[model samples]
Target: MGIEFTALHWIYVVFIVLIIGFMVKRRDTTLICIVGIFMLAIGATGDFTSSISGVFNSFIYAITELLSTILIISIIVAMSRVMMTSGINEVMVAPFTKIIKTPALAYWTIGLLMMLISWFFWPSPAVALLGAVLLPVAIRAGLPALGVAMAMNLFGHGIALSSDFVIQGAPKLTADAAGIPVGDVVSASIPLVITMGVVTTIVAYIFLRRDMKRGTFLLNTVSEENEDSTQAMEENLLSIGQKRFFAVLIPIAFILDVMAMAVFKLQGGDATALIGGTSVFILLLLSIVAHKSEGLEKTTSYLIQGFQFGFKVFGPVIPIAAFFYLGDVGFIQIIGDHLPATSHGIVNDLGVGLAAVVPLTKEIAVVTLTVVGAITGLDGSGFSGISLAGSVGSLFGNAIGGGTATLTALGQITAIWIGGGTLIPWALIPAAAICNVSPFELARRNLIPVVIGLVVTTIVAMFLI
Candidate 1:
């Protein structure tokens, strides 16, 4: 059925436009989103008093929805801190760094390794795993820190996340939305994903190489040796024996975690849960070992620090996410189930509206589906909007006589590539923080390649259909 396009739906659309405009202006949209939530609530409830409560409730709901993601990042960061302190973090990556003697090798090795780890454990956790270890090595090997960040971002967030082959979270969302089997979505995504991945990475890499050749990408303000020396001094408190033991033990532990994930066929939340749980255990064990009687205090201190970092990063994100969460059906339960059952979700309604209004030629359908997917990704949480993409893809496919799986895969590819972290500052934070670069700058660097990839992938998708 087509959407009725209520006043509330129109309001959401207007606010979304405003949000994108604000993003383009490089202005914060958090307060704007909060106000949008308030207005939308007032419109939905039509009671001034109830609408006031809706504002707080929307934020709370947003936090609740994001808590798991925040918590896992926090826990993993805490574990990383402990490993760094024990010097095990350095040890874990030292062996691999030796093979990365040249700048080209540094770029490709880090990118490939990041992709591999991200495929299994997801990118956020993988960032924590490799950031401290691989970053310095890449820097020392003559890879600009920014280049390292790009490799990690493009490979992990762009390539691995867009496909999400090992975990299947992305595929599951797309498949469910499109009313197709997960296997079909995954299968259809392979060529599109590879096309997007290869084109984007190569373009980005070429840009990087040109900059390096021109000396435009040279390390600035921080000599690699000085940075390495500082880190070495900071971590020198740990005894060689202790470092060796933890280094050996930590890799074994993570290897076991990886094996367990494979054995249990765990992906997404389950895999993250296992990783988080293990990180916490390792954090506690290492803290206790290091501080002995004061281990409890140290553990608490570390956890507090981790949470501070996590929540600080999440503060700007929450309000923005709150506004978008309202677009999905998932929020109805939190917003209240007492509303008219006929209320369609904002994103779904928008998709349906597009299907109803747009002319349904093959070219129009392909382009429209890609555009819809990109619009959904503006929310910054790539995973949240994919289901909408899938839904819209299915609608477009049915209307235009294309393969539903092909359309769905195109939608998934576009959504994840844009929102999964490559071009969005909020989504790009993990990689940016790892490489000590500005997220905005990183996003700016990513924009050209990703857009090119999307265009190429969309063209390939039209053929697949």
Candidate 2:
């Protein structure tokens, strides 16, 4: 007989519901979810192992699976820190100040720039560079700070990072889970990303334009304005030569990095590595330029500061990601051996069961899978939910006579775009925090345009795939 819905399945159901409830409550659900998963794993394994050992084992397994991706993220983030300390980040964005003359232009400029930089360096570092440099200009251009934050959140983290066209981290994970080539995933994602980008950007522009017309689009808070003015006064007292040299050199280096990446056809992650490594080198060069003989000591201080900033920006995301790693078979195989055999891979098993029941057309199955991906994304970290989506896509693809790769890609696109930051405040916090806006309010504002764009993107994916 086929497997029944045992105690393990019920436990999984409870945990899933709890997770959903916690997300809605906007509480710190990481520990709760982890505990739930732990209990479920124990029940599945039918082991009376110590809770401590189980937790440690599960954590170790999850961390091992995620170590590479996490380390890569950290390295890039660390490199970004080096750039900030050297003032290269500020120098890189200074030129945009001259071109962004109005709120509408500022929005697009910031959005496009964030997307471009994020494509190379990932969104975490891109936020720092944009927030520190372009934000003041954007604010001065009368773009509402909230709007600027939203733009960065949507374009940088959501669209660019989600697509991960350059680095391929996101695509690699999705493809692995779906059991397809990274190249295929990348190829499939391009049209979907473009469609989503255009639709979302247009919708965002409408909202921003309406606000601009109403004269409510200025995002510069009083405190930040005072801080900028104070810094300006301080800067005016210093000699301009140092600033001028840095201003020119930083941009040149970054431009060269970009050129090299494009000309060499470096993969996304490799391109990010190149950018990050160059940024570090530039940071070192600038520290000497800024501090003269004291450059060595100052550089160390700067590096420390940069790491602190990166960690502050990315730390919370780590644990959240750790919990979600449980859903992946790559990690599950290692940690879930202790789980009752019946409870093993509850997520994938659930997907298989669901696929068995649903007599879906290709179009219907694609839409349903995409919707499920989007729903799973409500947890706010796009990568966390993708494994389940990919697994379900594969199962349903087989059941409904569709391509697993296509369905997985569709699900991946939906999840990343929705939960990656485009529609959720918590997921967009890094961008929002750097832009100095409230994450909740940013999410509220993003609801309409992002949702509309998602709907359009989903329709397009269904027809295309």
Please give the RMSD of candidate 1 to the true structure.
Answer: 4.8
Q: What are the runs in model 1 whose C-alpha is more than 4 Å off?
A: 1-5, 116-149, 160-193, 207-237, 337-346, 361-448, 463-465
Candidate 1 positional error at 239, Å: 3.5
Candidate 1 residue lDDT tens string, 258-286: 89978987765676677778878989998
Question: Candidate 2 versus the native: TM-score?
Answer: 0.76
Best by lDDT: 1
For model 1, where is the 10-residue window of minimal lDDT?
Answer: 221-230
* TM per prediction: 0.76, 0.76
Report model 1's TM-score to 2 decimal places: 0.76
Which residue pairs in candidate 1 have backbone atoms (N, alpha carbon, C) closer than 3 angstroms, thus clashing? none
